[model samples]
Target: MKSLTSIIPAPPGWYARWRFGTHRTVTYPITTWALARDTGSEHTIVVGVDTNGMWPGGDDERPGGEFLRYIYEPIEAGTPDDVFNPVKSPADLASVG
Candidate 1:
């Protein structure tokens, strides 16, 4: 899971997957929104997501899983002024950790 800032929505467009034989192709890019954190008390779906987690490819190319980032609004902030803070980016995540 990449950092929230690193989590970017897919560009608005049609992405068609090839069909097999007479099967219909799925060409719509579904947009999804969510959040990830180092810790959380509640989650809408699953939990314990390691943003730094990775998945090895069959050819051993990119091992950082199918996703490169995770997007989400913070539940509670680090401080009172943090509520208005801009979202963080991958470079920002690199600086923090």
Candidate 2:
């Protein structure tokens, strides 16, 4: 998997066959979220995936798989946070590994 900071744009529907162990098709941009781990904080990055394998668009040459940066509020330890919970960007979060 590409690092969150290194995720550049790519063609649409490109992630359809990107491989997620199973034959999973990323049809919607809301299909998944990246959970970046850290010691004090964690990040849930919202992303978009191919709805169809066909890359139909006016800008075929432009990078695809582009996503909006997800902004959220900070969470204290022992607090519950869902996918929609607010948190800092992955770039600001330092990883344990």
- What's every prediction's RMSD, in angstroms? 18.4, 17.9
Question: What are the lDDT scores of the predictions, listed in order?
Answer: 0.28, 0.29
Per-residue accuracy of model 1 over 1-97 as CA lDDT, tens digit each: 2223223343333121222234222122224322433334333332222222221111332322242223333335222221112456657534431
| Tens-digit lDDT string for candidate 2 (1-97) | 2223222354322232221223321222222333323334454343432333222221331244333233222333322122222254655322311
Backbone clash numbers for all candidates listed: 3, 6
TM-score of each: 0.20, 0.17
Model 2 weakest 10-residue run by lDDT = 12-21
> Using lDDT as the measure, which candidate wins?
2
- Model 1 residue 39 CA deviation in Å: 21
